[model samples]
Target: MTAPGSIEPTDLSPLAWRLLRIAAGYEQRAVERELDDILQAHISMLESGSRALSNRRRQTLLELYAAELSPEQVTAIVEHF
Candidate 1:
């Protein structure tokens, strides 16, 4: 049994990141410009679940997308990690 408000194991899929990014109206090039260290190819790989994001990168993305995401979406993404 899972606790209330906790993320399910299946919710940890990288697709959440991709969905949130799209919902926030960012394309790969825009995300790359926002995250200087990451290239468009890397963003593509991350969205495709072929790459893993470090904690720092995740935090950066959270901050970047916060303004665009709903409170519930933000909470879900935060819990996903």
Candidate 2:
């Protein structure tokens, strides 16, 4: 189990990094919409290992990806990136 101030396992996987890079060129709101309102700064911090990924954030991310991108696409990105 996670302790107070401990980071969650879902701290921006490589796939998320790739996605974030791709999303960077788009408007902020678009990324937020796709990423379930997670601020880009939070994502940046998480990617840099300076912040934790909370359980609720992880669930929100999963739901957003599952709803927005296809399972096969997610798998391919995870495998390739």
Candidate 3:
């Protein structure tokens, strides 16, 4: 989903779009309860660009995703997002 004022994916900040895509993929692969509820909520807010991620939240999310994804995939996400 695009942000409130964003008409397309291109309108999203690079990191926001990447996070959204990653979240979308993860959502398709597992149930919501598998993810940290706060992180999930933050991701939803991110889809609308209504809130920015805090450094602590970002690190927490990375740790959670890293636990579920391959190292290579985590590396790519770290580099890009």
Candidate 4:
């Protein structure tokens, strides 16, 4: 899922990438749908680069997406950005 080339300057921001990665890694439609429930226009806006998440939303995304990484794991990844 390392499509670094797919990302452009106007694409997802670092925080958005961190959140989107959680959903992209899983490829779970159900979770994606649930994500929409939690945030308004979250799916389309994120995919279209019309939005980048807040720090709090990013954490909610990882939890909602059931990512393999723990909060510590996610925090470490985020720190690198």
Give me the displacement of residue 13 in model 4, in angstroms. 3.5
Q: Rate the local accuracy (lDDT) of all candidates.
A: 0.68, 0.53, 0.50, 0.49
- Write down the TM-score of every candidate: 0.70, 0.53, 0.47, 0.41
Candidate 1 ranges beyond 4 A from true positions: 1-11, 76-81
- Report how far residue 70 has shifted in candidate 3, in Å: 2.0
Predicted structure 1: lDDT = 0.68
Q: How far is candidate 2 from the true structure (C-alpha RMSD, Å)?
A: 7.5
Pairs of residues at least 3 apart in sequence or in different chains that clash in candidate 2? none
Q: In order, how many clashes per candidate?
A: 0, 0, 0, 0
- Find the candidate with the highest lDDT and give its number: 1
Per-residue CA lDDT of model 2 for 20-81, tens digit only, reads 44533434355566675588776666556677667687655545544555556544444444
lDDT of 1 by residue, 1-81 (tens): 333234332344577777778778999899989888878887787778897777667666656766687667766654664
How much lDDT does candidate 2 score?
A: 0.53
Runs in model 2 deviating more than 4 A are 1-15, 20-37
Residue pairs with backbone overlap in model 1: none
Worst 10 residues of 2 by lDDT: 1-10
